[model samples]
Target: MSFRTGKDFEFDPINGTNIIAREIGFKQTTFYNSTLTGTHKIDALGGFTVNWYGSFGILDQYIPLLQRLQYNQYTNLPGSPYLALISNGLSQKSGSVFYSTLSDYLYNAGGDISKSFTLFGQNKR
Candidate 1:
């Protein structure tokens, strides 16, 4: 059995814009994955052997937040501390927050049976 987890953050920004934008945005995400697998062999009649194998896995993705806010450039400039920090919290302005989650699972199973034989002093299966 094995397990793994990860977290990520992004500063996606339109470096330089002439006009038509007054919105601030940020994004964050998290994920986790796990797996389990096993195999077994059994003895059967007449020298025949049987093999069984199976595996299972799962993955989850969570986007905690994709926060966005549009503050007036006329009131607070881009470099101002008010714009840099949530100085006044949310207000009556163009604002949006988006989030999502996803899950995936999979499984595999198989079996095989075979016997050995001798022909003309050579081994055959």
Candidate 2:
């Protein structure tokens, strides 16, 4: 959800409001030494004002996996993750209005992983 308001104190008043709603669902099934996954996204925006801007978004994901046993057995697992973000901004003036505005954003990410494996003689009997 987001909202913004602005007005010319000498002449009149200006204001606005906005709201949003969303829902998502997912499911998966697997039988083997593999994995399956799915995702969903929803977003909405609406408002009324002078020199006003806003946005909202929602994201959801689901995953299911199955692994085989070394001898005789089975394993089942399921997982899900979700995220949401909202932002709003506005600028206005009155009585010979004169102004300037600016905005900026920055992001960075990094990761690393390592693994090792070993093998034995084949059918050394």
Candidate 3:
């Protein structure tokens, strides 16, 4: 299992704009294995095996509105005149969190036995 997170912050004194971002996530994995066998002269040979695995994780991002756009001579102006540019900037900051999980397992079992006897020439059972 593991956990991680990150954060960033910036300030523009001239434009009086501040940018902040943070992220956090975690991950976990599990595994299992087992085997069984029998040893006997008269008995058949038998064995079994199993394997299991699992994992999970999550991630998220956050951005302040002011940090979405580059504060400059053109972007600094607040009005519908730069609607396209401003909307683009907002889109950049718009982000969503994500999560994922996966789990699976495998199992196998088998057995075999052989015996030799004299019938006509040779026989096996």
- Per-candidate Cα RMSD to the true structure, in Å, reads 11.0, 32.0, 12.5
Would you list the rank order by TM-score, best first? 1, 3, 2
Q: Please report the candidate that would top lDDT against the real structure.
A: 1
Using TM-score, give the best candidate's number: 1
Report every candidate's CA lDDT: 0.46, 0.25, 0.38
Q: Tens digits of per-residue lDDT for model 2 on 49-85?
A: 1222233323322333221111111112123221122
TM-score of 2: 0.16
Could you tell me the lDDT of residue 60 within candidate 2? 29
Residue 120 miss distance in model 1 (angstroms): 2.9
Residue 10 CA displacement from its true place in model 1, Å: 20
TM-score, model 1 to reference: 0.43
| Better-scoring candidate (TM-score), 1 or 3 | 1
Per-residue lDDT for 1-125 in model 3, tens only?
22222221233345533323333445455556566655445433342223333333333333222222222223255542322123323244333334555555555666555555668887534
TM-score, per-candidate, Cα-based? 0.43, 0.16, 0.31
Residue pairs with backbone overlap in model 3: none
Model 1 misplacement above 4 A: 1-44, 67-98
Better of 1 and 2 by TM-score: 1
Cα displacement (Å) at residue 112, model 3: 0.8
